[model samples]
Target: MEESGNAIGFLENKTILITGSTGFLAKILLEKILRIQPNVKKLYLLLRATDETTAMQRFCNEVMGKDLFKVLKKKWGANLDRFISEKVSVVSSDISVSDMGLEDSTLVEEIKHNVQIIINLAATTKFNERYDVALGTNTLGAKHVVNFAKQCPNFKLLVHVSTAYISGEKEGFILETPHKLGESLNGTEGLNIEIEQKIIEQRLKQLKANGASEKDVTIAMKDLGIQRANQHGWPNTYVFTKAMGEMLINDLKHNLPLIIIRPTIVTSTYKEPFSGWIEGMRTIDNFIVGYAKGKLTFIPCDTNSIIDMIPADMVVNTIIATMMMHKLQPPYQTTIYHIGSSTRNPIKPGDLLRFTCQYFIKKPWFNGDGNAIKVKEITTFNNFASFHRYITIRYLIFLKVLELVNKASCNCLEDKYNDLKRKLNWVMRQVQLYRPYLFFNARKPKLSFRVILAKSLDLMTPT
Candidate 1:
């Protein structure tokens, strides 16, 4: 096949292996590629499953059946089945395991021979994921993918999808470069990964030795992950482990064509594969849904803080364009691409708040009683102390009154009120946990904010 300036022409005959095909980003990538370039040789979708049958089921239900692929479905019509059979294949594998947990030698050999591009998109995005799980999937799992790439004779590019937050609780400009673990940022030394990993292992062993229940072990591990993250200067386990994954790739990418795409808070599609298409609730979407339902009243945030967000379809486009650039322009070295909008077209928390209110005004939501839950202007706080004070003075005192009433009423409503009290306390704890990001004032000289420089994709940088 002759490669041309046209992206579809360039991608015509190359086989691609994509991990995390069931994920949000990967599904969008897959749909865009199939919809635009049906002539591409094949797509190996690696997903975690017990067998190929189960993997196919997941691909059909979770990926193809999703609203993201509706445009493609309309185009293919009666030929959709034939098109999918010719273009897509599912491999039952887990990124967290060695050799991608592939048991079949024949299938492994097939991948080794035909796969030219490997996209590592599988990762644990849970902010408080268990330490062992995060380490194995994000850190060690990445190492395994690199090893697999080393064996592929035709491998050309490995595009690792990462997050911009991997810069990790730092202020000022974050360069498009791989940062080493324990490397000083602003005169502060980064976390010692080796020592931290050992600490986590020891804590788990101690918990097991104490005959802790499974639930207790899980909770202990989650808490330990967060503690280690904060102790080492990072905000959470998700970003810390993701940063480690990047470091692993950096060490192993010697002489290989690798590009790391660090995208900021990914939102719905802006243009392609239909507009405003999004899956289940993302980070900020949680607040939107809760607020719309009138479940969340007060939130803690600095209105002026810049929150970098990029549309999912834009990320998919950038990924494809970057891959094609690398293919067309050979001898390319490892590069980091920060695909975000802050540096180009900044969007603030205040802007999002305004948009949400405006949207709901045009399209109001109603409660179960069939009454429009006319949303009031959401109250915001500048700091955790102030937010905590408000919660304590208003909600906590009210709960205390309920407790007293229950005590006076022969414990009549005590059980129900106690449950509500516990839930309120949990919400307060979550608010406290997330206060740093919410109330972040990037303008403060001492405060840290991520600055992603998007120099890689000069072709379509946001205006």
Candidate 2:
């Protein structure tokens, strides 16, 4: 797996189709390609919209409109629009549906004939997503993407972006291995996709028959996802569905050139397109934001536990390099690449906490009252039980007092009580979703041959 040719050279005059164009990593990938390879033939973006016009609007507002594209905008300046218009095409499509929900036959035919690469990045990333939705988007959506790729006669490669957490909450050195169709991590029998779909349909019908409210339905669906995931030995719905998606792709992709990239805890950009650029709260970013705003004061996590993280730019680079390598030397079988820092440059939760404290001490965040919030060392609980006990003693008792006070005041403090209750529920939910990672016992993933080759070529860097 020697890197013989330049990645830039490989992209020249190549037409590529990218799904999830509005997502975080997808935007970074799009930016890198357009900025570095102006000569690339075409970039067809599949967006979820009612029509092409709406899709283009989403592309402008969500994708190019992001700060990630600032560097490219600065470089292209006045010619930016023109360059984009010539090189990029936005199509209205939904991966959750068959044929990616593409109704325009002309556009579909055009893509089938000209597109040489299809990168599937669309996914439902919620830890406790609805079973039906997660199944449709992450699992069945993968099948749809593969079916679409089959129509492209000249398709050189299909890069499926997935999470490394798809390995679930297993303890040990996780490997870059492909999942087999209908396989369950716990060795549970009868893990059929068709059966799962049927179960979802049956549950929905029952809910409808019982006149379940929307809220009830949502809660039931989320609970079902968690139940099914746990039954199959996964910790959450997102990873469970994603793992199924990989299985489907691996099984369906008979002769197609495919690469599955599992990136772990993707953080802010490290170098390319500028550093420290991040959008929305993602994984650890939530903690960072919560801490900075003086909202997060304590956490239940082992300070010594390794928190695998990789920069957005590095992940993008690995994707590009992997694409290039696959094109140059297509493998006989599908390749899996784990893009993470746990193995090479691991950082502990304590290290991150210390860094956050030091940074905030120097430049404190000012609240709405224009007062600089004083920084303090975060309280860490070694395990969930201790944290639960603390929450019960500290917050629950106070909540009970608030309830009594509200009753005495004749609903005068009702809003405050309700708000506090909601916040506590949110906190509990968040802790449940994040508990697996906080106490994860798995060693770093064993890098695959391709990842090793890419790193050796200096195409990917951990720092």
Candidate 3:
């Protein structure tokens, strides 16, 4: 199939507000819009002010500093940076704030006068974040954006970035669907959002009163988010709060023309803007690293379980293409689009493991051992316990006798066993710390955000 440009004149001369402009998906989307729809009037980036002069510095250091925009730099030369700086202005903002962290009259007027579109991607993508931060960044942040969108004079589309795993506590065909979350999430969909905010404030105040370090406070908040997720039936704070955000967006953005693009497990770019432009790897990369380390031996996963893997580039292309179609067809607004690879392309975890093994044999980036981690499939029962039992009875016990000789001889296999035990203990502890959401089930609250996905699919037939 021929790859066609997804963005048309849809963005021409239009002022767009893009949140999460520094993130993986946002990077691709921003680059595509800039490169494809270069004439888009102004691009307002809403990012938190890390320090003084935050917006421009963040735009340069965060967004344009990466390798993803290298092509844009080379092609446009000096004009590219200038274009981004001039046409693309930054607003030091926070999604957790009442007005998306943009309270300045000038910036507010800039948005009301010039901005025509709002794309909210700013979020705490950390799966194990604090409940308040997750809620603030994910749920309430969207609310702030919606509220801001309501204030815009000539607002067009308010695109929300939601995850595909919003439907918690249920599992099945996992259709392109949604959930009616009235109170199940927080013991009473009526579980006052205001109360939670107040509690967060109180907790933070206590932290400050105790003179807690910023790092300590952050850690405590993350632990709280994880604890909250456990209290609820979801995986972790990220998806849980994202679920709440989806529900709130559905409830709050009633009058606004909005579409939620729910993409699943965004990976490296498969094409466009730049192919395979990946940096820090997270979910899939961990799998690759484990396979390379020869440690992820026995995985307990549903092999037929259809792992939905969509390339970030494809997702971005689909997102832009959807916007174009939506511009042409207005009713496509207020829908949730699952830009997941569940439709056509599917590569399972086992498949990924095998591929990593093969790839590593060819080009190895191994650990400090100087010896590559050997990859071999061990039986399910043979992970650590049963194998340990057999080895303990047969080999470890024998080695115990030999250890006396080995201490006499140094470098004994018995000593190796002890070292391995210590290492495995450490690994298990780290894994447990991150394991609040190994098995998660949440449904889409509604396709209210999916109109863009349908429109894009109709335009490009990606699946």
What C-alpha lDDT values do all the predictions have? 0.78, 0.87, 0.68
Summarize candidate 3's per-residue lDDT along 207-235 as a digit string, tens digits: 99999998999988888777666566665
**Which lDDT tens digits does candidate 1 get at residues 1-463?**
6455455566788799999889999998898888777888999999989999999999999999898888888898999999999888899998877898988899999999999999999988888889888887887778789889989989888999988887766666666777674553334564566676798879988998999999999999889888777766668888878888888888887777998888888999887777798887687787787667665667788888788788987788778777766653447488677777776677788888888877877778887899887777778877778888998898888888998999999999988788777757656655756655785533211111121112123323221
List the candidates' TM-scores in order: 0.89, 0.94, 0.81
TM-score of 3: 0.81
**Residue-wise C-alpha lDDT for candidate 2, range 1-463, written one tens digit per residue:** 2225777667889999999888888898899888877899999999899999999999999998888888899989999999999999999998999999999998899999999999999988888999999999999999999988988988889999999998888877888888999889899998988888999999999999999999999999999999999999889999999999999999999899999999888999888788898888788877877787776778899899888898998888888888877754555468888888887789999999999999998999998899998879988999888998999998999999999999999989999999778767766767888888988866656555444446434643221
Worst 10 residues of 1 by lDDT: 444-453
* Top-scoring candidate (TM-score): 2
For model 2 the local lDDT of residue 37 reads: 79
Task: Give model 2's TM-score versus the native structure.
Answer: 0.94
Total backbone collisions for each predicted model: 0, 0, 28
The residue ranges of model 1 lying beyond 4 angstroms of the native Cα positions read 1-3, 181-198, 327-332, 367-371, 411-423, 441-463
* Model 2 local distance difference test score: 0.87
Which runs in model 3 stand beyond 4 Å of their true positions?
A: 1-6, 50-52, 177-181, 185-190, 202-219, 328-333, 369-373, 378-463
Rank by TM-score (best first):
2, 1, 3
RMSD of each: 4.2, 2.7, 5.3
